[model samples]
Target chain A: GAGVSQSPSNKVTEKGKDVELRCDPISGHTALYWYRQRLGQGLEFLIYFQGNSAPDKSGLPSDRFSAERTGESVSTLTIQRTQQEDSAVYLCASSFSVFSTYEQYFGPGTRLTVT
Target chain B: AQTVTQSQPEMSVQEAETVTLSCTYDTSENNYYLFWYKQPPSRQMILVIRQEAYKQQNATENRFSVNFQKAAKSFSLKISDSQLGDTAMYFCASTLQGAQKLVFGQGTRLTINP
Candidate 1:
């Protein structure tokens, strides 16, 4: 089976620009998550969607960061007015549901660079 | 809220040798799950093993095993007969039962030397 896939494997943008990263979860997955991994750091949870509704958005760093999932399949993370601080690898993961027992399958992450 | 910590930032072991990576977590919830994930240079996160809070027996997958100490809140991963392919960043994560988000630890980079 195909694993979670993210589009635009690499992106370079100037500061103050906006960018959108896309994620395609597994066929039947109902839960999707977004995380940010800065260089030499751990994964930081950003937001998650359970069947198109985000139940936890507490991890979003600021108002400039937002994510949305539609049809319970594909998700998009948007960063408005990108800052150099936003530069990092954006990872997407999906699982069968929100259950802790289920394993989350991750994608090859899209590396975003802000200059 | 849940918090995970990996005391060791890096580890190196000779091929075919045994190695262990330590991880500790703090959480108020009694029912939860613990996981170990490996991220290679390709930046792909792969599930190495998982342990359920209620399960006393450690989880093992071939050469990878976890010593889960529920009472101490410590979950350590042991890799027996380490292989060069095992070289990567290992992260420990925990989440409450029925929770959607996971709290991750600062990864430990493991290197398998020949």
Candidate 2:
């Protein structure tokens, strides 16, 4: 079975530039999530989508960060005006459902560097 | 606000040995779930094991098991018969009912020596 997949395993861009990271969740998955992991740090929640509805966006660091998922399948996270502080690994995950018992399968992640 | 804590920054274990990783979390919600995830060099977050707060018995999966203590808000992962492939960054996460928002710990870097 195909697992959750993310594109552009690594990316380097200048400061103030905008970047888009793509994710392809497993088929039949109705829940997608985005998270950030900075160097030597833990994973920070970014946003979550459940069946086209994102119930939680509070974890997004700033307005420059946004994400969208179409038809509970593909998802993209956009970071506008990237800053040096934004250098980190952007992780994408999807689950069978948003229920308590469901397990999340993570993608390889996109390592974004704002140089 | 809920927060997960992993006090151990790094740990090491010889092959065939056993090791334990400590984790503690704070949440006001009565019902929630705790998870131990492994991230190897590949950087994919894999679920090693999970435990529901409502269940008293610990959860075990092959070589990976967790000691879940609801009252203490502690969930520790114990790896038995450690193998070289077990080396990675282990993160502890918690999510409360309906929130689905995961709070992750700082993570513990575990090294398995051959």
Q: Candidate 1 on B3-99: residue-level lDDT in tens?
A: 9999999999999999999999999888999999999999999999999999999999999999999989999999999999999999999999988
**Model 2 pairs whose backbones collide:** none
Clashing pairs in 1: none
Off by over 4 Å in 1: none
For residue A86, model 2's alpha carbon misses the true position, in angstroms, by 0.6
For every prediction, compared with the true complex, DockQ reads 0.92, 0.79
Candidate 1 lands at a TM-score of: 0.98
lDDT, candidate 1, equals 0.94
Docking class for model 1 is: high
Candidate 1 per-residue lDDT, tens place, A1-115, comes to 9999999999999999999999999999999999999998889999998885645898999999998888787899999999999999999999999888899999999999999
Worst 10 residues of 1 chain B by lDDT: B95-104
Overall lDDT per candidate, in order of appearance = 0.94, 0.92
Minimal lDDT window, size 10, model 2 chain A: A51-60
Angstrom error of the Cα, residue A13, model 2: value is 0.2
